[model samples]
Target: MQENKTSFSQRLTLLKQKEVKQTLVGILHGVERESLRINPDGGLAQTPHQAALGSALTHDFITTDFSESLLEFITPPEVSIDKTIGQLTDVHKFVLENIGEERLWSMSMPCFIESDDNIPIANYGSSNVGRMKSLYRVGLKNRYGSMMQAISGVHFNFSLPEAFWQEWLAKLGQEANKDTISAAYFALIRNYRRYCWIIPYLYGASPALCGSFIKGKLTSFEFSKIGKGTYYLPYATSLRMSDLGYTNSAQSGLNICYNQVDTYIDSLRKAISQPSVDYQRFNGKKDGQYQQLNGNVLQIENELYSPIRPKQPTRSLEKPTDALDDRGVNYIEVRALDVNPFSQIGIEANQFYFLDVFLLYCVTKPSEFFDSHLYQETETNLSEVVNRGREPNLHLTHKGESISLVDWALSLFSDLAEVAAELDEANNTNQYSAAVEVEKQKVLDPSLTPSARILKILLENNEDNGSFGLNLADTYKKQLLATDYQFMTADDLTAHAGRSVQKQLLVEQQDMQTFDEFLRSYFESSTELEQV
Candidate 1:
């Protein structure tokens, strides 16, 4: 570990050189924020996705997640974090204006859901790809239950500039190429897996959830009750990322490798190709209707859950892994963030700044190759932080040694502060250092963390999770609606919706093959990675 620290320090010194420092200026980022649309009464809205918001299948900025009520807002990749966030905010403003009486739920957990049957699956229109998209969600509902599928999150997509990669290759006396770039990303992923618990520790906000989410289900957690229908863990951070939410038992045996791109792609390929006995009982179809894309461990590569993923932009009709196999990692998507209820956009600018610094640090640090034992250690650490991050004297394992979470976090921040300072210099702004400082306070005083703040608000008001979230929903709606668009106009957004509707129609018209053929071809194309 001391040797690794020395390597990181040497790399940081190299990055601080004038010639290499300017290469950091173009770091790109994007955001994908998901929220549920709720009625005035705080019940999940049963209405179909609004036509005015455009086709969920074709829209570039707005779409639905699992259920029709679960809206996802996307911003295109931008070099400027401020512009990226501004675009996200503009999209939220447009969505709020167009959704009529429905308010976007503020928390990562869903609002009051009556039952699984009440949550309508998203409809993506009549194209073969569209039907495939909807069917994928159907499979998710069948496998994970609609309640778990209703949970929301914020995905942060990040990538350093090409110039930085070139500089990095030069520093290592290696050729600038896809393999080298991809290897660097995988190394970053390994380090990210080791320390990602910090994300939940600082930003996790789902300490409590409405009881409706787990109405008749059995849970291992010893939850205490709050005001009417709210269940909570007193020191919990993100129950949304816990076993109660996105974390599940189905993929526990995967053991997917992240040490290299080839092994990673191969693992995903095997999962999709391998049939699951439990899922096989569904027989892939039911009474002449397609039950799922297939009865495999994963219907597609996207089904494999992870806190972070190496990504490449997919071509039309191409699978995610195939794109990576063909061109290497284009960026990385951080999937661990819970939707911040306090922000109208579901994320904040300072959070983006902090993520930039953390991700850069992950890349700069020396990462040891992972084995199954080390991988499981990372998993256990993340689970500990997700469930009981704010508990006094909490401990997590690091390099097979148990350490106080606060102590580990403060040590990490010391390194993060250096990376943050370099980023501030490159970007010509102090936001990155400021962001790290703010998060450092959360590490020292757990009460300053988002989860603690949320619990404090709920406990003070004697409010159920649903009631508290609804209040925030109302507040954000008013605030967003009153604020003028920063990066887009009402006319621009309306035109985008109009264009998406037309694109959806065009896709439907262009479909020449049956849905069966389309599904088969999609699976067949996924196998190309194995051949590669």
Candidate 2:
């Protein structure tokens, strides 16, 4: 177990590398309306009312479970393993047919880096806290390719029970580590996923909830109608952060390939099919493009669109048609993950296969990477990707070298083929090879990626979509909808203000409070929950 200290940043980084944790990669998949889709001609399709409501895809389902649970529960039963290939496609098809289902789901895979082969590790949750944001932005990191955390720097989840937390951690967990975190810990998900972009590791759980829910004791029962777990658990993972920088660089000449996978999406969108009668396609025609998505793999890519909004020019704008450049990626949102809607496994097997290749590609390249250089080349390439990631013979860069996306993907597919074969040897007689090959073909043919098909959908729907930025009005609306969550919502803020004015009414009644009295009365009360 890792010990805690008072220094905030120092302790946070250290905690990420703890040993008694069961940490694994978390793949989040969310869904809602495509209010922000643009037409093939590059025009918006969002209406005024919808834009005001917000355009980013909203989530209707959310779940997180241990990695072990995933292979145990979500995997096909012993008798069904042989048919997993075609049947798995049916799962993808089910999802595609319900694009605007207004739900969010997630699964966890029990995975550790090949490097962590012999190490018994811990999962420390993470976060930048109040000052975390500026550090990442002003400085550069992630050069090792593995150094940078995927999505949020502090990435993790938990598997706690609602009743258990109500009886313990929420009341005394943080108090036990008061000298370190200087706060109480609740076992729930709040102000995260949607707000407070930063997540911290407390017990190697998906950002083990860190704050005492003093008033609300959900001891009897608690659950999201769509989520799998009754409550969250403590995060418990550790990290290996180092200071050496500049390991390698993309070279002038290398045999790299760059193939966009856009075309694949188009083909799938035009030909989906599902065995479930409720979602089966109409007449098996391409006209119902969604049918194509049936059983098609779900590769989610959530991204922040800057809209070319630059901060006020430091020295004033030069003034020209170049005033606004296209927005670059703030962070890529990878969705398409299926929530063990029925359970809380981090992610599915097929999902992990794609994620491995994708993340590995993002972090490791022949050439060295820096925050600055990546922004310069990647932003340009991203446009082409969003525009045509699935196009056959697409181009890409590796180790500072260029290659065709088709050939590059083909090469990767070959590697995956070997991996599938290897996995088959270890498990069910290599029966899963065909199942894995399915997506490889999807990538090669350039007709299975979503961004590729969305082009036509936006065009057919007359794509003149719009979006909103951290809007006050919109945020307030979300507050209204989620009556329970808060880090001080606008309404709570006012209540807090009023409460402060009347602080004298508190039990202390003393101008200066005493530490001993405060500790006993508040934290060490005889409540069954607060037993430190």
Candidate 3:
């Protein structure tokens, strides 16, 4: 590890000599924000997606995640992080104006959903693609239950510009090709796995939940009872990332490798194509409705849930893996960020800059192949942090040795400081190092962390996740509604909404194949492979 760190330093010095620091690395950023719509009474909003928000099926920036009540707003990739944030803010303002007495839930956990049946699955129109999207959600609900589907968070999409990659390859005297680029990304993913446990420790905001959420199942852990039904682990960080969040017994056994793009894709491809006997019970349709697409372990590539994923934007009607096979990774999605209840935009500028630094550190440092043993270690480390990150002098295993979590995190911050400084120099701004400094404080003082702050607020309010989150939601709602929409004009957004609706209609009108035939063709075409 010491040698690896030195190697990174040497690479930095070489790049510095080449004046790579002067190049403005295009740090493209976008955000996917998922929030459940809650009624004025703090219960799940039973209404359909508001028409004013545009057609969920065709809108580029706005869509539904798993359920109709869960609104997901996306922003276009922007060189400026503030521009991306501003776009998200504008989308939220637009939705709030049209939602009418409903508020977006501010936290990752759902707000007072009474029953699974009460949760509304997102509806798409008559087109086969739209229908497929809806049916995919149905499969998810049948597998994971509606309660889990209602949980929401923010996903950060990030990528480095082509020029930056080209410059790095030149510095290394390596050819710029898809294979080499993909290998570099896989290296980043490997390092990300090793250090990803730090993410939940810093940004985790879901430390507690309403009593209604758990419903008295799995009462093994000590939980603080604040209200009649609120339950929380005192030292917890992100319960959202814990086993209680997303789990599948069958999928757990699939130890997919991240050592190379081919290995990763082949593993996922097998899972999606392979049928699982566990899901067979729910495979057949009853009463003119399909229970699920098939008894496969995963019906599609999107079903594989991970904290981080290498991604390439797919062409129309293209499978995710197919896109990766054809083109190298376009960006990586950071999916573990809990919606910060304290902020109106769900994430802060400092958090974005810190993520940039963290990701850069991951890519620059040496990475080892991720095997089954390392996979379990990463999983265990994340679980430990999510449950008891704030415990005094907490320890976690690294390279088969136990070490203090705080000590390890502080050490990593030292490396991150260098990366931040270089990034700051390239951008000619102090923002990067300022962001690192803020996160460093969180490592030194856990109470300043989002999870700790959430617990503190809950303790003050009698341990009520629902009421506390709802109040914050309402406050943010007012604040966002009052703010000016700077990135886009109201007319421009409305026109975009109208255009999306027209596009959905066009899709519906142009469909020539039956739903079953369309499904068959899609699966058959996507599963076809070129001879190696």
lDDT of 2 by residue, 1-532 (tens): 1222233233222222322011112212211111111222212212111111111111111111111011111112112222332333332222222222221112111111122112111111121110112122111111112212211111211121223223322222332322212111110111011111101111111211111210133232121111211122111111111011111222112211111111212322222211323323221335422121122111110011121111111111111111111211111223222122111122234543443333222211112212334433543343333323444566766435677756655675564455444334433354446655655655554334322232233335433111111121133223324443222233433343345334313322432534334323432331111000
Global CA lDDT computed for model 2:
0.24
lDDT of 2 at 152: 14
How high is the lDDT of residue 488 in model 2? 25
On the 0 to 100 scale, the lDDT of residue 502 in model 3 is: 98
Q: Tell me the tens digit of each residue's lDDT in model 3 across 188-210.
A: 88888889989989999988887
CA RMSD of each candidate after superposition: 2.5, 25.7, 2.9
Q: Write the per-residue lDDT of candidate 1 for residues 261-314, one digit (tens) a residue.
A: 999989888888888878877655777777777788887788888999999987
Model 1 bad stretches (over 4 Å) = 1-6, 527-532
lDDT of each: 0.89, 0.24, 0.83
Q: Following a full C-alpha superposition, what root-mean-square deviation does model 1 have from the true structure?
A: 2.5
Best by TM-score: 1
Write down the TM-score of every candidate.
0.97, 0.27, 0.96
Superposition-based RMSD of candidate 2 using all C-alpha atoms, in angstroms: 25.7
The order by descending TM-score is: 1, 3, 2
**In terms of lDDT, which candidate is stronger, 2 or 3?**
3
